[model samples]
Target: MKFPLRLKFFVFASLLAVAPLVLVAQNLTRLTRDELRSAANEELTTVATQLRTEFDSTFRGRWLTPLMVIRNAIDSDALGVSQKISLLTLGLEELPQVVALQLSVQGSDLPILVTNESFSKRLVQNGLDPIETLTTSDDLISAIEGTGQFGRPLIAQISETGDWLATLALPLTSTIAGRQVTMAAKIDLSVLGQLVKRHPFAQRGEITVIDHAGRRVLGEQVELLTTRSIVSSALPLIVAGARADALEPYTRPDGSAMLGAYAFPDWFPWAVITELSEASAYAVSNAITRQILVVGLVGFAIASLGAMIFARQLTQPILSIGQVAERVRHGDFTARVENIRTGDEIADLARRFNQMIAQLGQRLELMKFVSEGTISAIRKADQDGISRGGERSSVSVIFTDIRGYTEFSERVAPEVVIEALNCYFEVQTGIVNRHHGDIDKFIGDALVAVFEGPDKEQRAVTCGVEITEAMTSLLEEYPEYNLHVGIGVASGEVVKGAIGARNRMDFTVLGSTVNLSARLCSKAAPEQVLVDQATMKAGQSKADLQFNQLAPIMLKGYSDPVQTYSALRHIQP
Candidate 1:
């Protein structure tokens, strides 16, 4: 406490007199809080579990069967485009919640969209057209792109009515009339409100759906809930969705308390949360402890003023440092404790900590510009620092490039082109990381990734297959973007090293394996993955895909044609 001798003595005497009574009051408060918390947990668990089951039954199983059948019928070449439309119309009847169905082809600006008769009339009443307005609407565009859902159950909200809708697009493996075809359906999510209304717990508490971000996806709040208060306090527990107990009671601004519990569905990103508003019943416990605390307050009144002064002076700077550290931990490196003026060892510690943080921030910022593989190499380098030298190491290299980006970019706006590229990279990067590969570099629309260790070839081939499939899905789901990818994988020896000017250096791998991969990528068709003989042999056991032998690939550097194998993008069964 840094207390002077006389002040310490005075404070000690005062605390000694009040200690017994303060202990009694604290014990009562603890006991009361625990009892109330336990009861709330048991009740909340039962409610949350029941709601979770109801949600699974209502939402998860409603779409797939009919959608899959419709998808298959569209793929059948026996059906003409009008016949396909007729089948889709019938499928719409089969799934009443699905309000609209749309069929679009790659590289086309217009699409065929069909809606239920009532919704079509509603569109007309709103001065809209099923073909023109809904086709060009932002929400429909987001749904086609599957913005939040990745590929299925694509969700977007109608701004005009504040209603949510989801889309599920089924793409044809065989192109119709030389153009790739996709069938999409818009599902009304107001069904969520209907589902929740059936729950009898409404009079006791509120039960609703929320996203991972704590936004009310669907609840009593019409459309998306803009209010941040109702369940935001319990959002972390809601997202975790692993606990079976209720939240500790939290008080609202009006002083009424709430108990909360949440459960997640296995098939969806949303969670179900139930909250009950209740009166706090701790008044009896407080009343019983009131007299004891009153006696203690008098005995400690003389020391309270000095204690508060000491705590404020001593702990405020420490608290600021702690807060900044917390922000730093969460990636806000800009936060700093700049107000410390203690002028003691604590102040010195704060100064050094800020300097250390600044240096770390600079290093981390630089790290993003380089490949993760390069970073790994640097980390494993000798402590004395890397020399301008290289070592031979075996690695599997996978190279990918966007197949028709030049034409796509020429036709699309520059910003739109960038957004499209980012989408492709995001999908490819996650696939690479999951397969234990590290990105080597991104050269314009081309990406190079490296995988090491015993299973490098298998990992590289699997990563390439995933990238092809992911890109295929992204393009097929939103064929409006009209882009595709070609990937190639090769496994061989390469020179790995840090080499450049003394002032600037880069860690990279260089060999025929890298060149071979690039050449195969250039020769690959859109949505195709080509692998060298070594990589293909090494990856024969990869269950996600199997290699199909390709014709010999002749390139500039090699006298003999290089043998290659391929894996096509996943075809939905």
Candidate 2:
């Protein structure tokens, strides 16, 4: 079946990586070889696009707009000349695309300013002469008569590396006169060279730029054609377009077999070509070819045995994973893949399988402790304890709330708020766990937890008091968070354990106890622990605890005002 070039490439690459030497057993496939070469050329064209984007983004889009605006704002022709020159020079340094920018006036042969100060000074000392270094086959005076933007490629030879540079010249004004200005910008080849140097394929790959005249403008070691034209070489292929173009692998003058040609951007006449070695491109396949030869040398009589050994070596990890998966299906969570070490996808699957089994084991252990029915209830409820059909039970409720949570969260990033919440939960949960409290759920910036459930009896008030005191001490120790909490405690007979229908269940407390505790928590101010009269009487406190009566406040769904009190300590003056 026919496939898109990219998809076909991925399939070819996968096969090459697996059985590289298998190609040697059969006749050389021209179609497969052409596909590989096409893929390589496509990759080089992609890189060229990346280069163009980088250049445009760095100069034309981001850094040049301000300079152009300044140029347009020029009122007087006299002072604007020097200012424009300086602006152009500044543009070169600020932009990565512009290697150099020089403004040459129509009246004088000398460039008014060159962006590189060192180069400018050198030109002055040597008597500025464009003819000596940069020769215009056609005079510049005639070229600047255009009304709009006019640009062309020039073969530029610079001081740095003798690399060919892409030079662009644009008329500073709409019309040419006795005195007009022109701006010239150059793209540094050193930047492209650096990219090639850092690239993984540079040693086996080549990037070449051929100009409009079919001359070798800028590239690595590519010999220019003395007789035949680059125009003749590229014109017919250019019509075929972005991915339809083809390259014939040819032997270079240096006797190296190199894949030729790549893509050219429509914006410019220049063609970018990449040449890579067949040996290096298909190195893995060549290695497999050698392995097949070795197998053949060992003798055909034992070929089946050798093939079995090879197949086993490749799939041992997969087999081990299959065994582990079977064990997990039978509830053996500890089963693990054995003696499998490969970086391929099989190894990845095996690792994920092992992790899955481990998670299953942990869940099974949780199931054992919480009872089968409770485990089923919790799983069906999700993380939030929202379920139907609430019942009544004797449950002790506690609420720890954060003061100024809204303002605090707003002041920081979302991630920072989450991180702080995690740290706060760790400390709060540790205190609850120590007091044998079963955490119900978090409600915004507050936590709702319960004491004396299932096994515990008659110690709800003591546990509740201990949790509050412990949390208060923790807040004082960690002043970095600037945290404070209001805790409330209440005890009463209500629906405990898992509440809701058989299909849906929540491990939470309901009835008046939960409602009273929540109301008391809301009444407490920052850094205060407020308890309802029920909880206070149940605690049987011995420590010197002071309480101040707060005004009666009406609550939601309650007809009468509830009497509230704030826990406080008096300081003797």
What TM-score quantifies how close candidate 2 is to the native fold?
0.38
List TM-scores for all candidates, in order.
0.46, 0.38
lDDT of 1 by residue, 1-573 (tens): 575544665576667767766776788778876686676566666677776776566655777567777888788877788988898888888888888887777667767677888876777776766566345343454465565542356556655566577766666676766887777778777777666777777766777777766666754344454243546644665467444434445555666677767666654556677776644334455666677677677768856766667756776777778888999999988988888888998799899889988998999998988887677767776877667778898999999999889999999899998998888898999999998888888899999999999889888887888888798799888798788999988899999888799779988889998999999999989888999999877878756667889789797699998888996433446
- Deviating ranges (above 4 Å) for candidate 2: 1-24, 27-45, 48-70, 73-82, 85-89, 92-111, 120-138, 144-149, 159-161, 174-178, 186-189, 219-222, 225-232, 235-247, 251-257, 300-573
- The runs of at least 3 residues in candidate 1 whose Cα sits more than 4 Å from the true structure, single-residue gaps closed, are 1-308, 341-352, 382-384, 477-480, 569-573
> Model 2: per-residue lDDT, tens digit, 1-573?
755443444444445443544554544444445566668766655665554444344445443464455345432455545566666656666765444665656666666444455444454566665334432322542453352334543445454335455555665553234566666555545554455456655566765555544556544444555233323466455444332333546666567666665456544455555667777656655665566667654544254445556656665676677778888889888798866677878788877887888888998886544433355455676665545554566667888888767877888789977887777767777767776776778777798777766433224444444545655675677665566677777777767566557665556667887888888788777766676666555443524445566777777767998776555443355
- In terms of lDDT, the best-performing candidate is 1
The ten-residue window of minimal lDDT in model 1 covers 219-228
Model 1 TM-score, all chains together: 0.46
